[model samples]
Target: MEETRRPRLAWKIFKLFLVVLLVAFIAAAGGVAYVWNELQPPHKGEMVSFTIPAGTSSRDIADTLETKGIVKNGSFFWLYLKYKGEGARFQAGEYEMTPGMTLNEVIGKLNRGETVKEETIHFTVPEGYTLEQVAKKLEEQNAVSATAFLQLADKPPTALSEVLAGPLPTDNQVRHKLEGYLFPETYEMKKGSTAEDIMERMAEELKNKLSAIPDFDSRLKARGLTLHELLTVASLVEKESAVKEESPMIAGVIYNRLKAKMRLEIDATVQYALPEYKERLFEADLKTESPYNTYLHDGLPPGPIANPGLDSIEAALSPKDSKYLFYVTKKDGSRTHLFAETYEQHLKNIEESKKTAK
Candidate 1:
């Protein structure tokens, strides 16, 4: 009886051991499956870019990665980093990521500092640049094809929405549909940006800048000028006043001539009518029959001749109090202009300018 009892006890002990081993194996298999799932890609093959700003915390990086769908679980990533003692290994830079990448691959890229470097181009539109000239400048930067830009200018896309509340010039003589709407400024654009995108950005900038002007609407109403008319006058002022200080004075001259029902006779207006810029306008050039020929028109031209800068736009809004009716660019290489209240004085300044030129 004692021997039989000993055999049963041993068999029972062996059965208990087998049961424990099976339980341990199942637990280990479950843990392995959980870890494999955690290491998988968050999504299918979709590439994305993210910028990790300086001094970002490990938890913050996890949150960003999760938000961008690059990681399956923020907590999992955090725990993995803590487990590997790699929480301090992440670098700050622009990083390109893909959903197809595993957690280890993502963390390895960040550890290796494999960041993406982007190229940008800067294009400056100077004050008083015509739409054509602006297009040419963009072409030089490879930002846009000049021909495509010009075509868009003629028939601007409806998607090219801007803050211009006023209608375009009704005069059939307007050269480009967006001649004076594109604000002049230096802009930094990413590589391979579209001409439409660049133009839209500039137009939005113009809207913002114009909105900041104090009492712009009241001043426009007081002067009986529409937004287009104001831009036209500003463009003229921009071209005529090389010296920024003379912007208001040139504006005054423009107003004086317009109020008197006299021809603007602005040289810049003639230049706009010409196919090409001319330092000197001949009698035949002035006779070119175009609505932009302010020398032949009685009042402001049909539309703006060029895109004006902030100073020129401000001068148009707040012209100086003066009786000046004429102005001529000085030839002393100072880019200064002589202002006069009488035609005789204007002729005298012209003569002086010629002498100074010699």
Candidate 2:
């Protein structure tokens, strides 16, 4: 009877131990379900705007999100980041978030830097614009002070020194040190960009454009022209060309004249020497006593007269193979030119051009 009592007591003790084990398992399962539910997106809140300052830590970001009601739990978000090994990949910027966004969505936006757009100002610098003209345009657009832009252009930024393919011309008569280096393009900058910033951006664009051309270095070398000279010739072509298709032919004419050691006698150079552009140039204008006046000078002008576009640059590098040394614009409103291999033929073409005016 004592042995029977011992077995029954043992069974009761074993059964009580099984019940405690079952209760612990149920409690553990409930705790896991609660945590998982808390981790999900709230999916019901207005959009919130925040800034993640530079060098902000992931934990701080998580806390900011929780405080803004973008997340249900900062600690859980922090843990999630750690689990995914992505805490260090967040970027700093102004962000807009809605609470409905999931954990993955929030993380993706931070990593991709989907920031709020700031106000920007855009201005276009057309091809063949002189440095002075560019400055004036900037002033008109209220982008930068014209005086400041000109002063900065006079002494170009040192950062641009590396971008140049050759040394900057030190000629006193070269109007501006950065005349032809600034590429012509529409640029967008922050509302308060400085003159140096704009100039540097334009110069860097020129460098990038040159780099994009196939075998540019070899083409420049084969032409036996320095970067400065190439720009000068390109500027000439740009000024002479009213028709884009005629640029290469005009470039060839300039090259032939240069090879023959003849004065360029370009009307554009004379116009550049004048204080302002004139619709019609006179003999006195051609006789202007400036180094930029190609009619008076023997070689390329002191420097490029204006910023040239890419087509003109390419024309200068690879001029059309022609013996033509002269061109006269047609008076027929077509903005085209007639080419000539001799002065006599040029005179005839000039007469023919005049006939079209009537």
Candidate 3:
């Protein structure tokens, strides 16, 4: 009986020893892994640029950094962040990383939001540019693709709905939602901004500037015109009058023609209807059947012919009181025009303009 008890005790001791060995081995392995993850660099002396967009998760950030070869292991990085109680503290932006950084070092940089500087570009949208022309201008600056910009202009972004109407017409027939809404001005934007982003910026600017005008909405209501109609007329005014001071006079001429129930006979509308704008319109251009052709269609064109400046918009809102119904650009070096009420006076001005041209 003693001999059997001694052997059983020895077997129990052996079993305890094996358990201790297993525990020690696991602990040692865990310690080694922790040290390796903390001290080991993912790569040696290689720099990479990584972008962390807004609202990205820790796991997704880890995965992105890992995929970019900026970090060795996403799982380990995630675990480290969780252990450090920094799982939710990562900042969003473009970050520059070097492979020589350890796990702790990478976390420190991301936590501090030490991101790379953003690349920005500058561009100017001149007044009187048509939607197509604006798109072409942005494309020339490498800010956006002309095709993408034009498509977006026709449909526009939803964010602009508060300031402007939908694609469907309200009181006036319009071609595109952003024809006159893309307020022309100099602008700066990040290099990778989408065309939609750029359009939204311009639309926001238009909304802000329009809001600053005293009684802008009340004035539009008094004119018996919607904002769309006002902009349409303003665009025509912009294209017709090169001299800033003549903007109000040009607006007056347009209003007088509309009230007289006569064709506008404005050459700028013919230019808008044609495939390409020209310095001078031929007789055939006047016969174009498009709704934008004021010679063929009465009143304001279906939509804005081009983007108008603030001066043109203000002129449309408060046109000069006048009986003048005609205007002819002088043939002399002056870009100003001659305005008259009767056909006889208009013809006389034309004759004088012709003589001046010679």
Candidate 4:
């Protein structure tokens, strides 16, 4: 009886051992499959930048990877991603993946945000942007407060004094604070920068761009432009001419008008005074007074009409030579104008314009 029991027990132990071996072999096979697939291409290596559309399922993404050759086999990626508990972690967006990247590395990028560090803080301050114009541009981005930008322009930083040798003139009641020195261009800013920082960067860029202006200081002196006049003329140029090539002629016009002691009757100056350049002006709007009236006050208005561009600056330095002491826009709105040195000729142009309008 004892011998029979021993034999039976031994058989039972043998069966248990076989079961253990079977489990071990299955696990080994799985490991081998996983390793074997890793050596192959994702599919065939077609994807450099992969876009996973929104709402893609695990199987769908794996299939896409397989079709693109980004994975040698989709089954392995599926199993691997699932085992790592990353099935739902694959973000939907543009992704760049490579064969050199391990399954773990690719998953990590997706989980962290399929998005590399990026910024959207890009906008421009046009060559002729006034403090108000700048404020409106910034307001569109929400990077800084427009009100704050405008207020700062009214009281430019003392630190800026080192840069703006000829800022806007303060004596003129018509002129506001630092309008012209803002220097217009596109600026990149942090998503959440302070208004002061925005102002400083703009000021710094302005100084740099303007510094390259040859004999800018001497030109400022000759024009009696207390930094203020430069800004004013710059503003005028910015407002008057869209073509950089025409800036010199525009500057010459400003110079000629000043030379003749003529009223620089620029509509832009009127617009500046009204702070509503966007609206169409009636004759009454032109007649209003707030210091920026170039028609009434004469002598270059109170301040810059807009933020002047580099062309305006260059134009101010090198005005075009002409006998034109007066210019009036033609009725065609084709930029055709009448240039007159005599009052009778100028009056004749005005009468012609009225007849055309009638």
Provide the TM-score for each candidate, comma-separated.
Answer: 0.73, 0.87, 0.68, 0.61
The whole-model lDDT of each prediction reads 0.87, 0.92, 0.84, 0.73
Candidate 1 lDDT over 1-358, as tens digits, reads: 9999999999999999999999999999998888778767766767888999989999999989988889887878888889888859899999989887877788899999899977988999998999999999999878899999999988878778544545555566788978889899999988988888888888888888888989888988999988998999999999889889999998988898888888999889999999999878889998998888987888988889999999999999999989998888788899998888898998999999988883
Q: Which candidate number would show the highest lDDT if scored against the true structure?
A: 2
lDDT tens per residue, model 3, 237-271: 99888999999999999999899999988888888
Regions of candidate 3 where Cα sits further than 4 Å from its true position? 1-116, 163-173
Query: What C-alpha lDDT, on a 0 to 100 scale, does residue 180 get in candidate 4?
Result: 71
lDDT of 3 at 243: 96
C-alpha RMSD of each candidate structure in angstroms: 6.7, 3.3, 7.8, 11.5
> For residues 1-358, could you state the per-residue lDDT of candidate 2 as single tens digits?
9999999999999999999999999999998888898789987778899999999999999999998888899999999999999879899989999998899999999999999998888999999999999999999999999999999889877786876655889888888989999999999998899998898889889999999989998999989988999999999999999788899999999999999998989999998899999999988888889999988889899899999999999999888989998999999999999999999999999999999984
Q: State residue 264's C-alpha deviation in candidate 2, in Å.
A: 0.5
Model 1: lDDT equals: 0.87
Rank by lDDT, descending? Answer: 2, 1, 3, 4
Show how many residue pairs clash in every candidate, following the order shown: 0, 0, 0, 17
After aligning candidate 4 to the native by TM-score, how far in Å is the CA of 171 from where it should be?
3.2
Task: Name the top TM-score candidate.
Answer: 2
Which pairs of residues collide in model 1? none
**Candidate 3 clash pair list:** none
Model 2 ranges off by over 4 Å:
40-47, 50-69, 78-93, 104-114, 162-166
Clashes of 4: 17
